[model samples]
Target: METVSGHRPTIIDVAKRAGVSKSTAARALAGASNISDSAREQVLRAADALGYTRNALAVGMRSGRSGMLGLVLPDIANPFWGEVARGAQDRAADADTSILIFSSNRCARKELMHLSTLMRARVDGAIINSVADSLDDLDRFGLPCILIGSSAERFPDTCSVGSDIVQGVGLGMDYLRSMGHERPALIVGQPTRLARARFLRVVHEHCVEHDIDPAVLLIENADYTVEGGRFAMQRLLARNHGLLCVFAANDLMALGAMSAVREAGLRCPEDVSILGFDGIQAGAFAWPGLTTIEKPARQIGAQAVAWLLDGNADAKPGTRVHLPCRLIERGSLANLCDASARRVGSVKG
Candidate 1:
């Protein structure tokens, strides 16, 4: 990546190219305020031609507030987290804030370290979807924070915005149960508060009340990754005979489970009905267009900001807020007595 002069183009060169002062170029490139539109366009074009990237660290330090928010998510590649990031960024921009993003990949120690780094930066605020398994692990954030997909009960003073896991799983169970899926398989999330463990508890309770076996096969925990979900589904299919439906904790795992079903020579909703949580865009585009629970991610993100900035003097330190999860029926489910079921029955006969 060499320039024609065999030297990297500097900020001065950008200013000269754009016919603007050094200060003006610097401000425009850093997204500073009060710069004329025409001048800003010139600087942007000049920077583009020079292939310039701003030194955010230096700029961030100069501005005490960083005008930035730190977002810590379990996995950036996951669509659900991607939506969270989208919502966070959209709202932060509205508030004239920037975002510094990081992915924990569901490691507790890594998440804590990231929080510490954000605190050190004196970030205006942090939006975290942490996988901390205990209160001690979550207590590390000594800054204004909003926890997405985590409970307010765990962190008293912190603001939380999460989809109702209990209700989401219950929606899936209710649909499956109504479809006559008496022997459904379950893919539990990794035993963290928001992702896996709570949903499992809700479904387990539903099973017991309905007089279904509380201990069914293919029930296991994994990181909320596609590969993890696929592996879990494979293990479940091998161990669970006569299973009619599979409920995944998240959309990624649900899509992975669909792959596993296809690999087992089964078709969705016909041979086996699969349901998932997190009504992300990718799920709607899935081959069978996954049936799932819709989480109001953008709404949650915006409202979380409202809560944190509410400036309520009497607001309790830790107030838990749970958003409702709405069931979305789609192409991935069918009654056990449907044509696919009859096909399986004929094969067995």
Candidate 2:
């Protein structure tokens, strides 16, 4: 074999130099399951001599198993999904696999196109956290898929992993009630899917049980942004029900609500307590800090990949794995009833 130093060679170059069929060369390069040791060694030696690296793109086109798991998410700018991606990558590495990512930014069309791309790439599996209305668009793809932060009701045969959002939201309200905040408002994002709807429903149920007027504290449905949070909070505050606190569906809105509180001449925890969902890092740095339910973003990512590796994606569409959440207390919450202060006074005495 004539060798050109410092120049890359193709798979055909490796096959010719290795004295093996192109198919044999391809399988060895792809690290397929059933290749004989002798052929693999020859392919490796020839590949090295020819300065060849496997063209994963070409290999993916020819073979159904690209050894890649594609992760499709809505709004990559959100820190929560970033943690999810990190967890997915870690789990994929543990399984000797790689990941591909596409962000839809909450657009249904973009999400559909990205899924199509993943299919064309021949990815072995996919982990999708779509903002689409339902799994109807997804059902047509016919690929091994796991939906994250989405339900499996329509497609009862696909694997899914998500937070126990109902329980998580309920836990947040329970904390507020315990803290002596009688009139609490909800700042929820526009309901795009089941997850958001369940969160709103759970919060409402808790409000009703506690003798709180559900009408006075209904969620301020708006965009899930800092500005949207501020707007929703402004409207909630105008009602003048002596609302002592507000619970945002996620941390971004929580931060926004905090901003609105300050802008409206109220000190957080003094005039109004604030609570956010999603244990995002930003919550810790916000002025006065934030009390929130810690969403298992990273764990969701890890668990999704684990489920895929465990062959759960192939079982049925509606299979779901709901992970739990915990509460994080911080300066943003102050007991309007002075219960926390009284306890501290008793300790000092």
Candidate 3:
């Protein structure tokens, strides 16, 4: 057949070459069972000869599926979020779908704006790791969503996948206690009420279990940024210079806190032990590798996409999937008794 304007061959060209109707050619190319095998074979042969390619946009328009997923993160700059994004991207690729990621900068207003944009784009579904107080607004979007991390509990109507924060905190606190640190402080992330509250409750309960005075527990809030961690650590030092250890909510903050310790002429694991949550890769390269609770951030991200695309359709509202975290020992943490003995020996000399 003569080409029209010498442009790439279209499905229409394939239809004509195969001696079949346009609908039959389209259905055959799509592998629809209703089309006879003979017709399907003819369409396939014609498509190969004409070099005809299917248009994803046209397919989406006809099927009512955009084949796109949305990922909303509080802060993409953080390595933890990067790991999560990688996981989501890998999973989306496996499903032959695309992912569009948006960062909210941990702001409620910006998060709403991103969600609105995604809705206008008609994404098939979304996975949000939001710091916003309420997820009730999400219902208005009418899109399937899966909450990541603590936000999952805040919105019971959506499916969620995350590490068990309570268990993670407990594991960290218990490890510190075993190492001989009694007066350990906590440096938490931005003021997300539920997450902050859960971490504090776990810290307090851990203190009580160890017979450590709850009143002596020092708690400070940072923006979950490196600088925020540095400032929070400085403030903690200013208020209580005798603290033997500190636990940060995430790794970036932990690294910052360690920097603050060095600025104050103190050494990690020797002068003041440090522990962190979220086992981001950067932690392994820190001055004294961070001792942290390793959350399966990548796994969580991948699972969120799976739930949104394959599972959420049949899952009951408010379904939560909690993954476990493990403790990673590194140079940053030291046994309290060992630290004390060294200090006493130096004083005597």
Candidate 4:
């Protein structure tokens, strides 16, 4: 049956075209087991011919279960977040759902606004990577929500999915120690972020375990951008001339710090070694390449989707999932132990 003018094609139209009852066409389109193979094929073929498609929104409204998710991120421009968003989108597609993404740009008001919009849109659940605690709004709305990254730890009793920052920092520190780099400085996020304190704690613990006093260590904050990293590196350089290596909170900052080292008439790995976190692809192609701690960013995104949509009660709220991280060795870090051995041999000769 041809669709009437100014009207969208529906299952009725498909049924008329396929010479079947409306109920039979619906069951055939829905892949119901009761539908015969001949009827199913006819319904599918008729739907194709009439350009008929199921209205998921109508179906969801009638069933009171829309398969839509909301994802809110601090900065979508960052490559790390890009990978996370990609993973989430892919996973949502697999689950026959859609994701509505919003970038809050680390603004609390913006985050609230986006959350409100998601609620108004009737999304089933939300995945939020926040800058501040967002639990109160959650209680008010009574919607299922999950937090990602540092803010998740701050708010107890919320489901969160994130990579292990502690393990990542530990890998960087241990590798630095093995390379014989003692005076390692830190380029971290601003003090407002819970992540800054988290990184500081890990580095301080590492130094204490290695018998190095934490007070003497250099620590500066950056905006997780290249320019921010450059400025932070300049400040750290001004305070210390014997900087052997610097570990940045992310790869972009590390790349910027590397440029700052060169601007100071020094060479990477020769004068100042740099280590980065967040194992982005650009780190592999950087000049002298960047040694970084690889976070499972994609897994973080996908896992959040999985847990959010889980109908089972096993993944309870306030459950925090911390995935592991590892080190990616590259040329940015100098092997001072090897250089020291060569220096000793030359002096003896």
Is 2 or 4 the stronger prediction by TM-score?
Answer: 4
Q: Which ten residues in a row have the lowest lDDT in candidate 1?
A: 340-349
Regions more than 4 Å wrong, model 1: 1-64, 133-141, 151-153, 191-194, 216-218, 311-315, 337-349
lDDT of 3 by residue, 168-243 (tens): 9999988887877766788996664577788888888888887888897788899777898999988887875454
Clashing pairs in 2: 156-317, 156-318, 157-316, 157-317, 157-318, 158-316, 158-317
- The digit string of per-residue lDDT tens for model 1 on 102-124 reads 99987878888888888887776
The residue-by-residue lDDT of candidate 4 on 1-349, one tens digit each, is: 3476768888888899999999999889766899889989999999999989888677667767667988999999888888888889999999988999999999888988898888877778888887655567655655688888788877777888999888888988888889877658889999887888999999999999989999887888889898999998888778755545788999889999998987887778777788999999889998889999999989988998888889411358578889999899998887867845321111000
Which order, best to worst by lDDT? 3, 4, 2, 1
Best by TM-score: 4
lDDT-wise, the better of 1 and 4 is: 4
- What lDDT does each candidate get? 0.75, 0.80, 0.84, 0.83
Model 2, runs deviating above 4 Å: 1-7, 11-51, 151-157, 191-193, 211-213, 337-349
Q: List the residue pairs that clash in candidate 3.
A: none
Q: Mind sharing the TM-score for model 2? A: 0.84
For residue 109, give model 4's deviation from the true position in Å: 1.4
Instruction: Report the C-alpha lDDT of model 2 over 1-349, residue by residue, as the tens digit.
Output: 3456545677778998999998899889777878999999999999887778676766667665677888998888889999999999998998888998889988889999999998887788889876667677876887778888744444556678888887898888888888876556778877655656777778778878887767776568867778888898888777665545788888988898889888887778777778998899999999888889998999999998888777788865567778899999989987755644522110000
Find the candidate with the highest lDDT and give its number: 3
Per-candidate TM equals 0.74, 0.84, 0.87, 0.91
